[model samples]
Target: MGIKSFQGKRTTTNTKESEPILVSDYMTRNLITFKEEQPIEEVIETLIKYKISGGPVVNEKNELIGIISEGDCMKQISESRYHNLPVDKNNTVKKAMITSVETIDGNMNIFDAANKFLESKRRRFPIVENGKLVGQISQKDVLKAAMKLKSNTWK
Candidate 1:
């Protein structure tokens, strides 16, 4: 007897490459948008009503022009107080909105998006497609994606 083979047949494990998870898969499509000419009071009201920190500012054609946030509103308020003027409807979003905005592509990988958030210290990033604002990806979205894929390989 040749030492009696007792082990069963060995099988090769399949190691196929899975498709990369994209930002569009987890981005929020229906976003609360603001207008450049919109009054600061209205924007503040909307922010409070919606419980959102900030929103994108659009033009008449619905193109992304800038972003407005609570910080921007605070700046306007501080300026008003310094100048002894009331924060009225005359103060528009255009005056407080950040014109130099950074946008991300929807097709980007979720991991890359997370890295972007870390590098920029941003809570959210606007997703633009074909010169139009399509959606937005936030840190929470990435966390959700990570939780959903917890059972799978992160790579």
Candidate 2:
């Protein structure tokens, strides 16, 4: 058998151009966060007004403490209706928010973010940097990134 000479490599210094896509590249920086002590109704209003499904719950220091979603609000509403009690205005975001949050670093690769989303069944995740909320990444963002990648690859 004879060895065949391979000659199909491109000699271009575009390594940076092909760098892995990161979560920060596609994450939404303009986030609507809720205060930990804010009323749940306010959180609901914010979510509805922005047309978003959920948001991060932060403290006075702008540090992410939990996450509040429409599901949480729906649960409260259902419970109140079942119990025949009027909606409680004293309910705070901290009361209904999930304390244990799954956060991702901004530098995480897009593929990793996608896998995390699939595993967690969460629609969105708060992007953290140095324990501070920097931005948010959602399933839509991942899809956009993937679409962009597909387009680029096809070209």
Deviation (Å) of 63 in candidate 2? 0.7
For residues 17-121, could you state the per-residue lDDT of candidate 1 as single tens digits? Answer: 877889999999999999988999999999999999998888777688999998999899888899998987699999899999899988899999999999999
lDDT of 1: 0.89
Error of 1 at 120 (Å): 1.3
Cand. 2 TM to true fold? 0.87
> Ten-residue segment with the worst summed lDDT in candidate 2?
8-17
Q: What is the C-alpha RMSD of each candidate to the true structure, in Å?
A: 2.4, 4.0
- Candidate 1: stretches off by over 4 Å: 1-16, 152-155
lDDT at 114 for candidate 2?
98
TM per prediction: 0.87, 0.87
What lDDT does the true structure give each of the candidates?
A: 0.89, 0.90
Q: Spell out the clash pairs found in candidate 1.
A: none
Count of backbone collisions within predicted model 2: 0
Supply every candidate's count of residue pairs whose N, Cα or C atoms clash at under 3 angstroms: 0, 0
